[model samples]
Target: MTATAPLPDTAGLRSRFDAELANFLDRQDPDWPDGAPRGVFRTLHRFVLAGGKRLRPLFCYWGWRGAGGADGTPIVVAAAALELFHAFALIHDDIMDGSERRRGEPSVHQLFADLHARSAWRGDAGSYGRNTALLCGDLCAAWSDQMFHECGLSTDEVHQGYRIFSLMRTEVIAGQYLDLVSGVGDGSVASALTVIRMKAARYTVTRPLQIGAALAGAGADLMTALAAFGDPLGDAFQLRDDVLGVFGDPAVTGKSILDDLREGKRTVMMALARDSADRNQALRIKTLFGNPGLDADGAAELREIIVATGALDRIEQMIRVRTEAALAALEQAPVVPEAREVLAALAAEAVDRRL
Candidate 1:
């Protein structure tokens, strides 16, 4: 067999992505028409650059390589565009969830709200903040599209990828809608899994991978193979995130451990816990799980209930199974050996993380 090439430098790629993102933002007209507020642009700059795992871009880059696309500026710029879209999703999601922090800093809406309060602005601070943040999210979405199209790739490659990009966007929005309804609807594991598949699974991993592969003119079979690998990995990824949301340290996660419980997110873990809870445990969960004013004691009780119900253990098992399935799929996928090795490592990192 021919010798496999060495693995690409992921840390260097991450730095390049960050630099490309910063440069793209810097090129935008932050100050326009003499009266437009620059704070929105400045905030977007900080929020995008502040912190992120950059999982989406890395997946995209690997997918490109797996499909025989060469390393170059075009792929890097295109992959980085995904980060802008992620910022849009996160900014909006935080507003919907009423989250106070992200990546160890004030969330976009909270920052704007605090600014309004501190400036003693004429409008309701909360409303002003939400509205401004909404605009900022919209701006990020627009920028993502612009950056992707202008990434210096051939028109055919960009066009192929845009189709997948559009579908990913639609699916995530639909999933978000389902998530809102699921909070009031039956909290079944099936429904929760549906949300994961659409909202996080496909959006997070599968679509990014497919978009990259498509850009490289990959055939349908390879695209399907990447999906097989990405879907399970993405499921495991979200499940781990759910665990961290409830159990992770704020200093480590840069998010409040209480926020998930407070929002009563209809996660698979919560659904499983509800399914297995005992009588008093069920009652306590009903009382405290979604309570906006849930305190430390209530959160502690909920954690105990989740553990006693065996929900935590079940979720962990699910994560392991899905992670294994993803790796198995990756092994069979018709990708370069170097890509396969790196992807297997990524799968482990995705499912086994404190953050």
Candidate 2:
């Protein structure tokens, strides 16, 4: 039996990641565009620096370590680039979803909207905010590429990492488009799973690991092994996120429960519930699920339908199964012992957390 190494100091990684972001942001000449509004920079900086679990960067770090890379600034900077990409994703996602809050604060678009309102800006306040936020998201995506390229890795390593990074960016944006289209028609578990695979699983976990491994000059076989572990774990993470979106406490989750129901998120849980619900139950869900003005009473009914149809239970089971699969893969993977230990713990935290 292989002995798993003790978990590394993740808190230390978090601190270093935070500092890297701050230093990078500080060095940027916010006034470089001359007369262009500075608020966009400030907003992006705040949004990026603000509260987040920094999960992707952590995964990248572990992947690099697992691939036998020594602890160094270059790898840390490379890993931190994933966080910038995630910030881009979140900013765009909030705009697309019309989410009012993120991490217990006003979302980027909402914050800018409020700014427009306060200043009595000409034209539509909401439109101005949305447009500005969109530009900011674009900037973040561009900056992510820039940071990833600028990291002090060998030319070959940088080239390899970029291949993975570019693919990740493309797939995630495509997945977002698919998610939007999926909301238009009858929700199917298959469609939802497709979105999860592209947007959540591959972008969130698999590719980050691959990118880090690439930076470490890991070969094809090792990359395949990491994907085997990462993909399933990512699925379980997103499934847990789906459950939390509807059932989790807003105070803890830092998101309103109503947002998912109001947006009619075509999550697997909703698909299963819709599929299994009887006539009236289905009708009740159909009527209330997407209603923006749906109140607590309607939400109670919707929750009841979800529970009664056993979708919630089934999703829980799916999380467990996928998590176990990820852990089992880790055991057989060629990653360094410490990476196995940390990745194992991360799998549990990703699926079993309340927030």
Candidate 3:
């Protein structure tokens, strides 16, 4: 993440929101009965608080403000609920990717493993840790709902928002399955495009925008415009993420590049490389994936191959094209100036960020 220059004072707006989020998280810490295994609630709380852009909450706020709604504690709670859902996703994602860090600290699984080893928990420490983290992720999912439950949205609005969220999860998981399945079979352009739309594009940008717009009682036409805007912005965001996953500074991204490459993610970059590679190129790529000692030199070679295949150029082209489309949508939308300015800034950051 770049050091953003100081801009407007949002302290008054942010403090109240932070309080609500913190309070909901606190409720997750129901005291354990004596002699029972302790829950990892506090640890999880720390994990969520470590760092994030708070993008969901910010969107919720801006959307509400755009609708001329009063900003208050309840609105803040509703906004914070969106982030809790993200926490649920991240915990599981870390486990799936076998990642060791989050927000520059040891990930939940790793932390549990270390605890097991140091405190001498019964059973295999590593196995125990994995199970604990998995459960913790499940717990986070439940806690997210609890946070949403506390939001003061009308029943109908809350139901609508949740419906969008439910669809969001299904789409994302389907995308994940597509990513996993692509590994076993030959890659196809059609399937790749489907996964891209379902996985990164919809959830990260489009749905969030829709959820907010719908909550604010936006008309169908406005919602349609928001969706169009989100598609390109979301694509740009994901493409930027893919680039960062491979080549970004670890200090900025808070995770090792090695994990993603080793996981053999069926990214657009990888899929394109496969499409363009010759027989010899195919054989080379097949060999290097998932080798534990696929070192820096090997990683660099793989990267070179990906770029040399002209896939990188295509991916870069797609980013530019989609970003332009998103900008055009924004230009056409009847968004107010204050919300428009922030959204514009966010769109630029989504594509142009170093991390």
Candidate 4:
């Protein structure tokens, strides 16, 4: 099987982690302070390449390929930049969410904090860890900017990519604010949908693909096709995330169970639960969500109630429907079949993963 193969299937793109990432890391260090180690680069590299879906890069590549771009080198490097950017976001996200793990491993900040605790850092160990990780996250973000600029794409394309990245940053930050507020009961489902579109769906899936298409010199028509397909597919992506946030395994997913509930996230599941439930059920939800003190049995009971109320089944159906809709959108798209393979596999497998 090639590197970009489908889940539980054979054959895929060349694994960009080793060769491509090594080259990317070379550009990161002009010089290292003796004995300090390239701690930042090493840690960021591990985090970025940590057994992941490589979804952003793959989305970017397939987007370019779908648009008939011959310049694979530029796109691959550009795609790598996307993954770097995602790592930057996730580092900060784990910090904000107080999430202990990522992709079934210690979150960068948590890892640093744990190390600091063991080694007797000067200040508070957790603070030391958080601050260090924050700096590293910024460094990684800067490296992404440098990578895209130096990826050998046209000047115009590079500038356009920067512009999109800027827009994405602004939009996702706003979306995150809305999401945070919504969890506290100050926002509505409409707002949650908006957040979903701006934050998770677009950056995680849609925009990366669009970036690839743009780099490929796709015309307005193809851009429209991509946008048309990106919106709903992105929604499905976030929806699955919501499901996983509630139901996924801690070990396999590398995130704590009921994380979204504990965080009081305004997911589609939460929204549906609120709308369909009785006042008692709603009170239970409100009381349980984001309660860090809630025990495992309490969480399990909540999950049971959610399932017994048919909410879990309802959410599953939504996933299935959204999955079909994404497939249909792809069918309607005017792209080469081979190019579609990676994306279709990603979309399907994102939801199909055991976690």
State which candidate has the highest TM-score.
1
Better of 1 and 2 by lDDT: 1
Select the stronger candidate by TM-score from 1 and 3.
Answer: 1
Q: Write down the lDDT that model 4 would get.
A: 0.74
C-alpha RMSD between model 2 and the true structure: 2.4
The total of clashing pairs for model 4 equals 6
| TM-score, prediction 4 | 0.90
User: For residues 198-260, could you state the per-residue lDDT of candidate 3 as single tens digits?
Assistant: 877887777777676666666678678777888888877888788778878899989788777
Backbone clashes counted, model 1 = 0
lDDT: which candidate is best? 1
Task: Give the range of the ten consecutive residues with the poorest summed lDDT in model 1.
Answer: 1-10
Clashes of each: 0, 0, 0, 6
Model 4 residue runs over 4 Å out of place are 1-14, 33-37
lDDT of 4 by residue, 46-80 (tens): 78767766777777777877787653467678878
lDDT of each prediction vs. the true structure? Answer: 0.93, 0.87, 0.74, 0.74
TM-score of each: 0.97, 0.96, 0.89, 0.90
Greater TM-score among 2 and 3 belongs to 2
lDDT of 4 at 181: 70
Better of 2 and 3 by lDDT: 2
lDDT of 2 by residue, 228-340 (tens): 99999999999999999999999998999988998889999999999999999988987999898989888878998999999999999999999899999999999887778
